[model samples]
Target: MKKKRSIISLCLSALFSLMLLFTSFVKPVNAAPTITLEQTFTATANPDVVGKWSEVERLRVNDTNITQELFITDNEHKTSTIVKGFGNDASPNSQLFLLHKFAGWNTATKPYPVLFVHGAGSDGDFAVDPERNGTTPGLAQSLAADGYAVFAITFAHPHGDNYIQREVLAAAIQRIKDITGKTKVDLIAHSKGNMSSRMYVSDVKKSWGTAFRNDVRRYIQLGAPNGGIDYTFRNTWAAWGIMATGAFGPVPYTYMTIYGWPTDTAYHSIYSAADGGGAYPGQAQMLARWDNVYDLDIFEQDWYTTYYGGWGYYSYSEGIDYAINQGGNLINTLKNTPVKSTVQLATLAGSENVINGVVMEDDGPSDGVVFIASATMTDPMISGGATLLEKKVLPINHVQLAYDPTALTWIKTQLSR
Candidate 1:
């Protein structure tokens, strides 16, 4: 009887050991619920082009920086709205794309409001994950799920001129103020959005005096072409064609003076006194017929064109043409933009990144659109003598920089502060 009892006890111990091993091998399931949306606006697949330009092929849900652990499902929290801009000649594209928590400004539990300004060629919806596979969500939507008052801006034209875009953004800011009852909101700008935001804070806000100053608390610049990019010149013909059509608007003049390669009209390489007083060796000229331009107004009434050796000469012609045909006042409106932000500033640079479809030669470690140095605002000139509260340089490309996990984490941390 004693032998039989001991054998039974041994059998029970063996069973317990097997159960422990099985449990140890099994991975724990995530406790957080996967969020599903009633509607999703993901980027469409680019059928015409190759190399991941399309919405379907480019960004991956798993590739995003957001982790399942931090993900939360909130059907009642996500909402979108279309706010019309105050532009006198505004088109349908002037409407701002707004996405936020359904509770919106009325929610007492949410933190400060955040405004996201998208880059050129895209609107506020750019942050939204086009892949509705339940794993990927838009940046603004994610922030909303995280219990924050987040708003995004999309213009009527989608590719509207920067001046017009700026006006639209100004109106958007006022709307955000009205809805949230918050006096000031934080800004997260990408690409040309950075220039747009900077123009508003440095120049446009001055027009409003103290009210504008009080309206902005923090500004985050991601992959900003603050120092300008040579990509425009590298593809000279396309650049010329786009300029002639006034696709990018008068802001190109400003970009030329700030960051263009030193080249005179007729595409001859020259020594530029503006670019840290150094000569670019083996710099390819953009246009053979391009000549030195006179009366280039980068700043208001200040015709300084010696920068980049005379790169302005070529760009100024485009600006002049834009001013003459499309709208001269537009060119005048974008000149000599001063830089000053009353709020705290942070910069994130995507370095060593390239896109699948782009063809322009990289000047340095760039995110396939803007260089890392430009995104970081390391140039003393573009930084406007203001010190950045934080700066990060990451190895990521232009399109995904804002959505990158590293960027989102830092942004979350900063917003918490």
Candidate 2:
């Protein structure tokens, strides 16, 4: 009997050994990599210098350098270059700044820290904390002065891919949570910044992206083109304006025949799938026709040919519809995918169509650039699961939404709740 028992115990020990060996060979699935912290420093805004980080006041910001391993791919999403930060020419992979006001603060009245995401062609420092010597304070400064910890992220490319920007935003939220010892943070995204923030909140991401971990408390969007926009396509002259200034991304129209410039068909053409999908994936993703609802501005030169597609007197265009197709119709994707039910959502739209003195988007109610309907469109979010805290329309233009006193007051009111 003793001999038989010994043999049975030996068999059990061998089975246990096999189990251990098998488990060692299997890797964990969908595990997030540790976000590396490069360094942390206090940044002071230099008023004399006119550039990215020089806009914000020195006393209000404590900048931290953080890195996220990103799969940087071309416009087509084919081949990827593994980058430590947002890998692009605008800002290097090493200099992705996460600006916050936590270290300098003495107390906290708010439960969660506010994370600010800037719009297209803008950085966090300039977007939230612009250099304005006036009685009115920017959103970031107001929030911080009221005893709330504020944080903002600056992307490598101001007009970088939303797919990559979404991942960058997720990393920023994680870093903020870690520093504050909080479970969640409040998110405030403006203009194009809303695209990445919404993508992160809805878990609507590329296959490489991490799922939404329910880390946001209040998701507030200011002057967001939530339903998407077709400003460049609708206003063909605007495309020229962009190309002339070398600001923003590539427009659908080519300036070859009109300006005697060589044709960059790959970058300028709507059909070209060359450079990471096209010269500007971020701008392309926000393409959608509002012409069906609002009349195209007839005042502009060659509005007919620009809208329909063909050689205009000035330039050539593939039309807005073709541009939307080339853009991958990202608006439809976001419309289908809803944010998690736990997050409370809010939207603020600018009703005033006149920006500075120019009447823009006159056919429809717009904040100069974005339509009110597009900005206030939250039915999809509410229907999916998120509770709508509020949807407000302020008498301000697109640019003033971030700095106007009234808008700032409304934002403060929402954050207080």
Candidate 3:
């Protein structure tokens, strides 16, 4: 009995020491970074005018940072009910596609509230702000006009290397809850948008508890790089190299990113649930009936990856994909994003490590900028929530999935649950 007591005391001491170490490491983790945007009041620049030129080279080469066109006075979150300049004027030739039923023509039935999410490196202007080279017939404005009260929020800033968009989205969700007082809301997100929603749901579940989960009912992932994408290649060799580069890209201090990649949790959970046996049975049901997109008509297993680069050395699928994803074609404003080949990576390793389908030239499946399998997530089941709500196959590419007609009906069906 004396010996047992001594052993228990030693164990207690060791446990206390470990707890102290853990708290020390955790101090920095809990604090999120705050970004502040500042612009000179006298200064004025128009992104529309500045964007007319790909002066990145000139700006960097000459160090000519003085702007003739700075954003014409900081437009502080323009929130108006009937935004004349912001909303689109229905054109004589404006054609709404594939909406003859459910959404279009039938004006009596209350059209479900639709949420529009922009991807990384983009602003809400892409959906609403016309002056920011913004698109007309924005999804939020149109859906709200049809019936549903819409919510639109952009990331605090334009771009980031990680999924910082999740926090902005979380704030948006909170704002949405405050306004509607509804039990559930519908969501549609594109690119990192899909993953951002996952992070919002997963993190809220883990950090805040399950109460807020009820506020968001259905999640629709449009043209999502759900699994980390491999921009290089899908082969085994290319994957290792991409991982080496991405890992070396930035030193991570937080587990906020799904794996190290921002948009990997849902994608990883989908694949893991599909393959992992009897591992958390709850997730198996949640992630069931998700979509994995593939353009089989174009190419097969290994060979399909090559087609993304296309036949030409100067193909749009090659170098320009990253360019479009990072920043749209500076020259051609109307370049339709045609992202193909949602190739699955071979395998995953490490605890937080996952195999994302993203790849680059001469590289394999990636993590956002890399391949799918290579990307990892913190808690996958929470990332995807109760459903993946995805888009795949014919008439579906990364860009087209954003407001795809098929995804609309499906989103409504899911939310009704």
Model 2, poorest ten-residue lDDT window? 76-85
Error of 2 at 47 (Å): 10
Q: Return the top candidate by TM-score.
A: 2
User: Poorest 10 consecutive residues of model 3 by lDDT?
Assistant: 92-101
lDDT of each: 0.47, 0.68, 0.33
Off by over 4 Å in 1: 1-105, 108-110, 130-135, 204-211, 236-341, 378-387
TM-score list, all predictions = 0.53, 0.78, 0.39
Count of backbone collisions in candidate 2: 6
375-404 in candidate 3: lDDT tens per residue?
222124333324433322322334333344
lDDT of 1 at 168: 50
Per-residue CA lDDT of model 1 for 1-417, tens digit only, reads 999999999999999999999999996652311222222232243222111111111111111222111101210112122212112222232223333322243563555688888765454545654232335656665566677777666544433344444545665676667657888788898877775576666654222222234467778888876655444333334334332343331122323322346323222111122322111110111111111322222432112333222234444433222222232232123334434545677888877565654533353567776666556654442345444678888777787767867778787777767
**Regions more than 4 Å wrong, model 3:** 1-113, 128-136, 161-163, 204-214, 232-392, 404-417
Number of colliding residue pairs in each model: 18, 6, 50
**Deviation in angstroms for 371 in model 1?**
1.3
Q: Which candidate would rank higher by lDDT, 2 or 3?
A: 2
Candidate 1 clash total? 18
Measured with C-alpha atoms, the lDDT of residue 244 in candidate 1 is 35
Task: Give the Å shift of residue 165 in candidate 1.
Answer: 2.0
